[model samples]
Structures are given as structure tokens and as C-alpha cells.
Target: MDSSKIINIIIALFLPPLAVFMARGWGQDCIIDIILTIIVFFPGMLYALYIVLKD
Candidate 1:
């Protein structure tokens, strides 16, 4: 796919909140990603991947 997406995926794997922030800006998606990351890292990572791939 796109290089930026690949980078975002890598970032998402390491830090989901940051990845969401980069993709969606300071919005609800970013907040949700932060919460999910705080609650459970795996779920947050998955959510971030979904968000990134969706666009």
C-alpha cells in the first residue's frame, strides 16, 4: 500500500495512541485510542490499525 500507511502501521504497533493522533488528529478517535491503549495495548493496537486502514 502507501508508505505513510506502512509507517503508521509500524507506529500503531508500538504506540497506538500516537498513530491515531497522526491519522485522525486531536479528535474522538484519538481519545478512544488513548483509552483503549491505557485499558489494553493489544486492543488499542488493533483499533489503530483499523482506523488507519479505513482511510
Candidate 2:
């Protein structure tokens, strides 16, 4: 994977919302990530990684 993808994955592991924001900005995906983080951490991480990888 690219360096940026690696960075995003690392960030997603630690802070899912931040990773989503980095990948998608302050858009719907980021908002959803934040909400998922608030509800549960693992789901947020998965969602963030999905967004990062999907892009």
C-alpha cells in the first residue's frame, strides 16, 4: 500500500474519526465515523479503514 494509506490505517487504529476526517474531510463519512466512534470503537475503526481503503 502507499505511505498515505499506511498512515491512515495507523491513524484509524488509534483514532477512527480522525482517520475518516483525513480520508473524507468533514463530510457525511466523517460524521458517520464520529457517531460510530461514540457508539462503539471497533465499528468506528472498521468504518474508517473501509473509507480509507475504499478511496
Candidate 3:
């Protein structure tokens, strides 16, 4: 992966919603990430990693 993806991964691990927003822009994915984060952090982080690294 390039530097950006690497950065996104790091961000995803720490802040799932922001990472999802960075990867997907403003959309349903962002909302989902936010909701996941609100419900529980681990799942949100995992989802963020998936979204960021799936390129």
C-alpha cells in the first residue's frame, strides 16, 4: 500500500469514523461508521480498516 493507505489504516485503528469519511467521502458509509462507532468501537475500527484497505 501507498503512504495514504498506510495513514488511513493508522487513522482507522484510532478513529474509525474519520477514517471511513476519508476513504468514502460523505455518504452512507460515513453514517454507518458513525453508528458503528457509537454502538461499539472495535467493530467500527474493523469496518474502517476494511473500507480503507479494499482498494
Candidate number with greatest lDDT? 1
Instruction: Go through the candidates in order and give each one's C-alpha lDDT.
Output: 0.94, 0.93, 0.92
What's each prediction's TM-score?
A: 0.94, 0.93, 0.95
Q: Candidate 1 residues 24-53, lDDT tens each?
A: 999999999999999989999999999999
For model 3, residues 1-55, the per-residue Cα lDDT tens digits are 7899999999999999999899889999899989999999999998999999886
Error of 3 at 25 (Å): 0.3
Highest TM-score scorer: 3
Model 2, which residues run further than 4 Å from truth?
none
Q: Which tens-of-lDDT digit does each residue in 1-55 have in candidate 2?
A: 8999999999999999999998889999999999999999999999998999999
Question: Model 2: what TM-score?
Answer: 0.93
The Cα error of candidate 1 at residue 13, in Å, is: 0.5
lDDT measured at residue 14 in model 1 versus the true structure, 0 to 100: 99
